[model samples]
Every structure is written in C-alpha cells, then in structure tokens.
Target: MATALPAPAALLLWECAARAFGLLYFPPPTSIAARAYHLWFSGPPAHLFLTAEAVEDLLPSLTRLVVGWTLAAALGLATGLALGRLPILAALADPLLHIGRAIPPPALLPLFLATLPIGTPTQLATILAGVIWPILINTADGVRHVHHAYLDTASVFQLGRARRLLYVIVPAAAPKILAGLRLSVSLALIMMVVSELTASTDGLGYRLQNAAGSVDVPAMWAVIVLLGIAGIAANGVFLFVQRRLLRSGQAARPRGHVLAWQQ
Candidate 1:
C-alpha cells in the first residue's frame, strides 16, 4: 500500500511515520541511515570500494546467488523442455515433480549441509538445490501450455530438430520461461540469504544476524531495509526483461499473416 505514493509524498510519509513510532521497534529511519552510512564511509578502505561494510557481507551472497541461479536455469530449462515435449517422461515425472516442488527447500538444509562441501561452495550448492525446483517446475508447466497449433504446424513442415527447436519450441515456450525466470530469481535471492543465515560466515544475512546478536538493532534494521530494496529492484529488472523478451518474441513473428503461425 505504501508503494502507491508519489515519491515526495512517500518520503514525507515515511519520515512522519518513523518519527511518530518506529523507535519503539526499530530505530527511526535516520538511525538506520546513520548505521548504513557509517558502515560504508567510516573506514580507510573506502577508496577500494570494499569500504562499504556490506561489500564483504553482500559479495558472498551475490556470488552464491549468481552461480546457483545460473546452474538452475540451465538444468531447469533442459529438463522442462524434455518434460513438456516428451509424453512418456512427462507421465513418469510430473507427479513426483509436483510433490517435490511443493516441499519447502530450507527443510533440506540439514541434509544438504551434511553431504555438501563447506564454505562458499557449500553455500552455493545449497542455494542451487533450494531455488532450482521453482524454475524447473514452472518451465515444465510453461512448456506444457505451449499452443497446440504451433506444434501441429511444425509437424506439417516436418522441421528438422535444430530448426524446430530454434524457431518453434524456444519461441513458443519463451513467455513461460520468462515467468519461471522471475520466480527463480526471487527464489535464488531468498535461498542465498537463508544459506548464509544458517551457516555461512559472511553475507548480508550473516551480518544481519551478527548485528542482532550484538544488540545493534539499528544496523540489523538497515540491512533488512536493504534486502527489501534489493528485492524490489530485482523484480523491477525482471519485469523489464520480461517486457523485452515478450515484445521481441511477438515482433519476430509474421503477425501480418496468420496461416503460418507456429507458437
């Protein structure tokens, strides 16, 4: 609800609200700002840009996020395509996939930590395992929803494997892929932080936990705000990409003529 405000009004409202009551639970916004500022500026390393305290904290999280999500995307898309296009595979795997996807990923943290490598590698592997299911499941769903007419047209043309996949399958399945990507992106960030909070020595999540333990509530709150801001910014970016992919996919088609339509 607060997001609907015009920028000026939002700032004003935020200031007023914080001044009125925020100190009861959190430091007012200014206290959070002071903590954020001191973290980034009150240091000699500022010239190196790692002076930002959370640089040390945030980098590991970002690293795990990027690596894990990329792996998930690659594997998920491949698996999803097979599930969507192959009847026997879909029949065999769909039920299990549904059940697996429904299970919360963090519940497996104990199992993962027991078997996976330690430190950064373990964090990344944990994030990947946790976040991958949404991408895989959504991509499969999207592939299944591909327009039937498109498949029939490809059949009529007797398209070769390369041509069929390049022209028909990928294009037809793109909107769904983009949707799945959005879900996976959010999942990736969540898992990245959760992994850190659970075990990693460094990360925004770790710092937040550390600050809380030290009773540095203002710093903890600042980190939480940053996480919220990061989530918003990431979704904005995903939406921008989604618009481009959707538009480009549409533009690639001969919308001017309908008979040759193939997804």
Candidate 2:
C-alpha cells in the first residue's frame, strides 16, 4: 500500500540507470522484477523445478517469525511489566539491557554456530533472541510511565486490581508497549533473514546469499528487493495500527467540562 504511487516508478528508472553503469554488480530493473515474480508465481520452490516459484516462500519465513517473535513478545511484555513496576528489578537489569542491545545479532552467529546445532532451530533462536529486547525494554518503560495520578484515582474508586489493570494502567501504558512491539516486528524480520543467511538451506535470506555466492545476479537482486518490500510493509502496518489505537484512546477519554473540583 505504501508504494502505490508514481514514486516507485521513479525508483525503477533510477535502478535501471544504475545497472547500465555497472552490469556485473547491478542487474537491470526488469530482470530483478522478473526474478522476484518468479519467486512467487513459478513452481514448487522447495525443490528444483524447470523454473522458480517463490510465492510460497513467505509462509515458511513468516511461520518462523510468528513463533519466534510471539515468544519474544510474551517474554518482553512480562519482563517489561515486572521491571517497570519494580524499581529494584529495573535497577538490576537495566544495565544488562543497555549492554546487550549494543551488540548486533549477526555478530553472535559464531557463538550460536558453535554452541547450537546447525538447523532451523538455531535460526528460530537467533531471531527470538535478537528481537526480544525491544519488547522488554519498551513494555517496562511504558509500565514505568503509568501515571501516579491514575493509580491514586484507582485507589480512591476502590477499584479492584483487575479493574485497575483493565481501566487505568494498561490504557495509560499501552502506547509505549505497542511502540516496542512495533519495533520488534521489523527487528524480528531482519533477524529472521539474517539467521537464514548463515544457517538455513532455504528461505529468502538463503536465496540472497546463494545468489551472491553463485553469481545468479537476477535471483540475488530479486530476493533483496522482496526483503526490502517486506520490511517496509511490516513497519507501515505497525504505524497504521498505532495511529488507530491512539485515536481510539483519545476518543475514550472522559469528556466533560472542568467544573472546578478542588481537593
């Protein structure tokens, strides 16, 4: 949806021009597009065919992403909540978080390679570990940022813990929590491909690395472009959801003129 404009065409023109100068490194636009088309519309890609059909590929990568990212999200939310609500826990773990996030996920491949068995499982773990931090930190910060006034209001109303959670704390903190997940959604995908780059026999990342390895310019270019599109689409979806949720939140706020209530 984001690319449904004349601007993409302009990019295609530039891509074509870039290729003209360096054919070896930069394949033509039509060639890359054709290769991308082949990935989706061709035949069974799991095994060799007369030609390529990559349309089915999104499912495998997405399945891994769903599993890994969901796990990360669950952990992130739980950890964020605990840390955000408890200063002591936050103090204990925040430093580790700051340190861990500084290291890139790819740099850890050698460690994973040596420690974990080589296969799909390792890839899943890589994506999960890489993506979890955003969720954890964001949720904690969101939870921390929950207004004291809200808590006080809940107390005055004699609201039960469940009611307080449902009506006050969650609403106040949800935007930031979602913000973290939004970030992880993209981070998870990048790591998903990165995992495949080193570990997988299949998937888009594998296709990209293999293409570069064998000099299949078309296929390499194809997967790279598709990956770019996928990343962009994921982010766009997150932003759209965030805006919608924020709008709903605004509408749900208590609406009344201030009649000058004094404590």
Best by TM-score: 1
User: In candidate 2, where is summed lDDT lowest over 10 consecutive residues?
Assistant: 254-263
Q: Could you say which candidate leads in lDDT?
A: 2
Per residue, candidate 2 scores C-alpha lDDT tens digits across 1-263 of 76687788877876878767776777777777787676675665554442344534566687888898998999888888889878998899878989888888788877888889986778878997899988988888888877677777779999997798778877778888888999999999989998988898777777788888999988887887877888899899889999999789767755431111111
**Candidate 1 lDDT over residue span 1-263, tens digit each:** 76676876866776688788755565667778898878756776743656756578777777788888999899988898888778899999978887877778888788778987767766777777777786777777777776767778778999987787778877877777888889888888888888888778888988988987899987888888888888888889999989988888788776742344442
What are the Cα lDDT values of the candidates? 0.79, 0.80
Score candidate 2 by TM-score against the native: 0.85
Q: RMSDs, each prediction?
A: 3.0, 4.2
Each candidate's TM vs. the true structure?
A: 0.87, 0.85
Clashes of each: 0, 4
